[model samples]
Target chain A: MNTTQTEWNLARRQIVGNAASIGFAVAMYGVSFGALGTTAGLSIPQTMALSLLMFTGASQFTLVSTLASGGTALTAVIASWLMGTRNAAYSMRMTPILKTSGPGRLVAVQLTIDESTAMGLAQDEEAFEGRASRLAFWATGLSVYLLWNLATFIGAVSVSAIGDPKSFGLDAAIAAGLFALVWPQIKSRTDLSVAFGGALIALALTPVVPPGVPVLAAAIVAIIVGWVTGRKLS
Target chain B: MMWFAVLAGAAGCYALKYVGSIIPAHILEQPIVKRIVLLLPISLLSALVAVQTFATSQSLTLDARVPALAAATVALRFKTPFILVVLIAAVTAAALRYFGLAA
Candidate 1:
């Protein structure tokens, strides 16, 4: 095949591959979030609005969990923002792929999220910094968004009558997706150490702090570990 | 209204993203920013792990039933399938509750 044709074909496969490998868990986790939000006392519209508007599953879940526990709107908003700070990093990583333009800029921002960010980076070495990767990245984001919101609505509607989420294995959905996301990134002993340290810090902080904050604290610990060890490696 | 908060929150989020995208390519391409951004996923994932593993229904617990530490260890050693590891750990917890190991 010609060079341009080859690039197009490869991009096509990457987009499809990302969807197959990562899409299901990303979408299903929305169901878990929806159910949990409803059980936490958010109404159907409230839950749907969170999924449709906020759309970051982690942030949405954190917001509702905090609200359920009596956290104010301001508190919930800050927590969600903190939870989503990683998207900025993802955006940075994708900057090269989706070249800065008026329309491209808006689309890129709309598509920024955990799965697309990771999937965009997962493209082959050369593709990582090219337009093809951006195409794949946007595809992943749009597909996940559509699928997630739809599944979330289904989950919210069903949660009221479903009784216990634990009974249906719905609670495991988020854990499963997180595991998938984290697994591919563990490339070295240092990464493993940082992971362990963060997980430990999170465990230790859980009792003293709220649910979402522990994760934030763990992230800080990992960043410190990265900064400290990063110099030696460089 | 709550809907307004949701819209504002959504708008704020997209605005932050647009701000990130608007930085000139040359500026964002700087070596320092690139290096730091590379570690962003680790930061986000760290937050996620801490919350899920440590925080329980209302309180944090180091109890055996949660066993996230152990499962993560298994995930490391076997390079086990992520979904499989999550299933094993989650099943352990639900089974514990089912069998009266913990509440």
Candidate 2:
């Protein structure tokens, strides 16, 4: 085949691979989130709205969990925003790569989350690099967005029929889903150490701090470790 | 109150993303920023897992989530399919609860 045709095929394969890797997992997790949101006292529409608009798993979960526990609106918003800051960082990393414009730019911003960014960056550096990366981004972003929303609707509607969400162990599913997403990223001893340190920080602070403070504190620990270790290595 | 929080959260999140998108690439590509971004997800996600697993209504406790997390970790280490990892974790927790071992 000609170079262009071969490149197109490679890009297509990469997009499909990336989408398939995380799409179902994300959709399933969306169901869990939807049920949790409803159980947390959010109306079905409100739960759906969070997924449609906020569109970040950890942030949405933080918002609902905080609210469910009687946290003030300000606290919930701050917690969710803090959790979402990573998406901003993801956007910065992806902006030059996406180079999108107009309406597409708006949509791209909406879809810029951990899964899409990771999928895009996972593209092979050696083959049809740019095109494949963009394809992976769009493919994973679009598929996850569509499937997640649909699953949210289903979960919200079926929540009553499913009865108590906790009895089904849905409460633990969030951590499991997050764990799955984070697992592939920890590639080395340093990464593992950082992860353990962060977890320890969060755990140690959980009892003494406000609902959301532990997470922010853990982020600080990670940042300090990153800065210190990075300086040392450099 | 709920509506206000949702709208504000959405707007804030969108702003965060837009600000990142508009920043000049050269600025974001700095070595320190790059390292921060690389390390951020690991720490953030680990924090998330710990909070979600251990905290219940601003309080910490030992519960089924601990063992479920352990199971999920093992499943992940084995490169189990994502769905299976979730299922294993959920089932582990549910069984523990059913057996009166956890709340």
Candidate 3:
């Protein structure tokens, strides 16, 4: 849904409503991520950097848990990178809508995560009335980014005062949140198969391989599935 | 090591995003590449679920998190919000742990 400049004049308030809701939801997770990061032994600044740079919740959590579980730096990076790959996929879709370069492109690409993309594309109605989607994108992205970072900082600081996070079962909270994040993406039969296969592969390999390797190794399932799908389409 | 991990992971993840941003849409739209891209996050996230719930480094454990995950699954089926799903799972595990049921 490419948004034209002439179509962007409205800068509708409806976009803000959607962005705020998404922002609030993410604000909750930002707190969780912040708390989880500290419990994973990340300093506030380290955790902040993750929220700031990586910006995506799944990738940040992946990095924390991987490193905490004694995965090597290489594996940690790769595993988190794998988790972050969806943004790349999101980026591919966002490129046309964003249609910017230089400094603007840098900022837009950074904001190109699930929330913004979802909001942006939601306006791609049956007609070519993709007018408000770009506003949705920018508003949702900026708001989520700001709220998430602030909440993350708050969570990081306050969690330490809460004593051992396990008592609060924050670990389970993190996993559940992550599963929720991915669940929306599981919309098709192929997606289901890949998820089941990936989890199976990871579980089987967990006891055998290093901490983060199984996560990476699960890519085999996706590759095979993709290959089969591609062959069918061709 | 952690500092390196954090910084490097951020760099690499952003680089991936940059690649997607810069790549020609036609190139990304290649059937195989598109399929693979779509599936990567699905597989990786499920792999993460298995890892998060069951495994700890080179070991495996059966803990309160097991039932907690089941509860989370139910919450998902009911279409609970993301944070609520997480809260339900957390409370499930916490209560189990409190009662000395699971470890």
Candidate 4:
């Protein structure tokens, strides 16, 4: 039952399709981030390079904003690193679902991120094919990576001819797109509680902490609370 | 100069991704660590939304942008398609901005 052939094929197809969907959505948000990077004094090449290389949207945004606000390069790097540390956790949690053999294992790790990891894990509980999980992660990550870099390049090069990208509502569009991705997943009391805890913590600490650090702090608090809740329930 | 940072950052990011799988399964399966790891996405994503929605240039706004939050709430409640909810939020925000009511 756990490793049936037909089920594996179906899961593979579903994962691929969802990966494409997630990839396309994530790519759309790259336009906004690219514009933002340029406006923050990043050259087109730098912005595109960031998109191509860094590939984590939140961390990229955090680094640029921190730098723009007079943060040292080291500080910006640290902040971004802290923000993106979730990928490490994602990789740890994903081991059971994506236990690939041979060379493809490397690809699985590279592709693991918030969306792919989350989607893959969600499917795994339903016993999705291990291959499907890997495919989804790669398809989504590669698609987003390519689209993001390309979009950033285009935005950076066109900035002089274009007016404020914010005025074009790019920020809102991206925010909306992200919300689109996130809103569907807020199920159960546990999920809601963590969200509430995180939001409250961030709001409370925003004035005291640096921009991105607050998010990291809130995340820590949320995880603690969630762990405590799970223990209580058990 | 920035490219150096970018390249270094990217390399670091990719290298870190593979670190978990390379470690012994026992390391990843530690009960406490496993619990925390499993909760990472929920916590991180929640924090991201809180920062984006509430903090605006170091201040919190309860204006038209508020509708984006509200729309998200309603969409989640009704189980509407995520894309539709986002579109609604954007439209609501644009209307608020149009009326000179939002920051």
TM-score of each model, paired residue for residue: 0.71, 0.83, 0.91, 0.69
Winning model by DockQ: 3
How would you encode candidate 2's per-residue C-alpha lDDT over B1-103 as one tens digit per residue? 9988888988898888888998887765666666776777688778778877888867887899889989998888898976788789889999999999988
Each model's lDDT comes to 0.63, 0.80, 0.84, 0.64
lDDT of 2 at B2: 90
Point to the candidate with the largest lDDT.
3
TM-score of 3: 0.91
Over A95-154, each residue of candidate 3 has an lDDT whose tens digit, in order, gives: 777667899889888898889988888876322354476778889999999999999999
Q: In angstroms, how far off is B31's CA in candidate 1?
A: 6.3
Candidate 4 lDDT, A1-234, residue by residue in tens: 554877777867777777777777666556656765776677777888787767777667666654543344665565566556667767777866677757777777767777777776665454543556556666676766666677677656665457654444334444454455445456777777776776688678767766656666765764586567556644
lDDT by residue (A66-126, candidate 2, tens digit) is 6764566777787677667778788988887888999999999999998999988887644
**Relative to the unseen true structure, what is the C-alpha lDDT of residue A77 in candidate 1, on a scale of 0 to 100?**
66
Query: In candidate 1 chain A, where is summed lDDT lowest over 10 consecutive residues?
Result: A168-177
Instruction: Order the candidate numbers by lDDT, best to worst.
Output: 3, 2, 4, 1
Clashes of each: 1, 0, 0, 0
Q: Candidate 2, A57: how far from true, in Å?
A: 2.7
Task: Write down the lDDT that model 3 would get.
Answer: 0.84
